[model samples]
Target: MSTMIFSRTDETPGIHGHTRDCTGAKGSSTLAKLGKGDIVVVDAPDINRTLAQKLIDAHVGGVVNTGAFTTGNVPNFGPQMLLDADITLVENVDPELPGKVKNGKKGRLNDGKVYYGDRSIGQGEVLDEETARTRFLDAREALIDHMEALSGNTAEFVSTEAPLLIDGLGIPDLDVDMDDRKVLVVSPDPQLEEKLKSLRYFIREYDPVMIGVDQAVDELIGHGYRPAVIIGDPDLISSDNLRSGAAVILPADPDGHAAGLERIQDLGVGAMTFPAATGDATDLALLLAEYHGASMVVNLGPTLDLDRVFDTAAAPGTPSAMLSRLRVGNRLVDSTAVAELYRVSRSGGGWLWAILGILAAVVVIVLIAGLSGSDGFVDNLIDSWNNIALKFQDLFS
Candidate 1:
């Protein structure tokens, strides 16, 4: 019902920047703060798919962004996600309008104009599904042009000093039984709940090792699963989860400090710090599992959507995440397929139940024959049943 501006600039062109309705936080953080019926005025040059997805999940009324959705800025699928969610996304809005809005405040968008506290300040162009489609295609083409510049060389995505950074970066020395074990790596993605439900049987049957990444710890506990290890920034994870007896792993900052270590230190629980890597917490968790020699890794809520190229300094195509997967190889199984495999395993026991049912039916028929005093008929039925059983056994043999 109201508008909030996301900006980093001192002042938007033609509009005042120092408004109470504006947020200087990044787009994803801004979306996290805003909710349903909120209007997000993105003053940044581009929004990533992660933030776009947040806006969609928030069920926001609309997004009035002043920045262009170029290949370098916007995530590839950001525009499509907004369109599919039917969230009104107005690109190339008047830059000045965003600054007019307040931070943590409400405003309205109507008739190509933004209104804050009942006053119209600036105009914006509304992007429909068709327009979003055209924009996404153009962005893809531009992305290809940029990729051509790199000549498909993935080595460029990694720093030459990566080997130095990773060498001897203190990883967790905790011993985990990886022999024929199913290790479940969980992420804080929204689809995690559904995916966890599908894996319930496998979880109960295999009793796999659970590793929660960041906010995924909450999901794991909420779903009645205890994480053997929780890794990530403590700010995103709950205090209870951190104290849940799980070994904590966090990215060691350049200063050799980890954000999560401070939270768990007072509890007398120890934590291991690894050198900060390119990908987010989920990637780090996967790498940790691989390092520990997990027999099979089941990933839930992993970032599989590769259609993003935000304007931020974050690398496109997620080389670090890809590298983590390559490290794990065929041992990595998606949650959906894992659930199917578990379901099939459970169904395999159905024949035993069917045979039991047949035995019960035969007993009931024998009782009926006894009660009716039909000895001859009962004897013939028994003979025939015995013959049938023998024939079945012979067929199997």
Candidate 2:
């Protein structure tokens, strides 16, 4: 898919930037380490929006991927995103090409030929936006085939994990009380930050058993609400927050290695391990809530997309994710619904109840602090609710 090259518009069609090894295989983990203007050398064929957004956020200058940009089997949405951001994208390079370019070394691109300090390291086809868009349209035709394969895999997973879903075989007990209560599970999704701004009021009202996966837990803690459980690695959260008495559950490796156990032990924090979960940790978090007898669960993350089964970085529609959703059924409430519920309650004639709820919450916080020696927890709850009240007063008055 050769197209016109305007990577650099000066005289020659080329770009010069520092080279960095960043395999798309490692997903966002590698992208998070990159700095602005560094050229990423990656190995992702079906790059999705999440990966591209990470590169955009890191302000990378270009991408050198060994895999063909689009093979018609899956969509390569990231290529267009990169090209739109004015980042040069060269693909189908030799498999060994990424290794020759050392990180922090100035690498130059001239008409799809990669050079490491004036020496040609490899040659590949560079893509323009028009060509990438054409390929992406063609790739959509193949998504049904991919969906069929994923459906087969989903059937297998349901057959394998049915016992856990039905009988609660591997679900663990937690210090947090969840039975008959609503559960709020937050994950690292694009909408998480903005959605939480309004949903914090829902938190104030429901006081759902809070579960946070990945660094999204920090968002909740920053809003003055500590998660009752943290379902990612201990290192994923701040050290101070990690010690704040949340039930920490790290996902074990598929081969039985306890992932993040050592880090939790090093931090001297109490933690447990969920069996290696399929897809994202957020899936397991939702399943955990469902099996723990949560009356309802509110999921704060990317809505599932079955077409993205191949995206390892939080593909919303992985087969395992499908299974988790099927297991949770209607109990898994979307954040949008939660938002609507909050709006309705705010508009209805219920100001007296809201005031009474806040007053009762304060009394409960004081009693819990006095009886349980959780002074810090009480203080945070008070501060968070007080902030909510001040905002409400400002908005109405």
Q: RMSD of each candidate?
A: 14.3, 15.8
Error of 2 at 143 (Å): 1.6
| Total backbone collisions for each predicted model | 12, 0
Q: Tens digit of lDDT per residue, candidate 1, span 127-235?
A: 6777667766766676666556434434754563255225424455776665567899988877788889888888878899998888889878987889998888887
Error of 2 at 389 (Å): 40
TM-score of each predicted structure versus truth: 0.56, 0.53
Off by over 4 Å in 1: 1-137, 145-169, 308-317, 343-360, 363-397
Kindly list the per-residue Cα lDDT of model 2 for residues 96-203, writing each as its tens digit: 886686767877777778776557898789888888888888777556655666677777777866776677666668867889899999998777778887797888
TM-score of 1: 0.56
lDDT of 1 at 285: 77
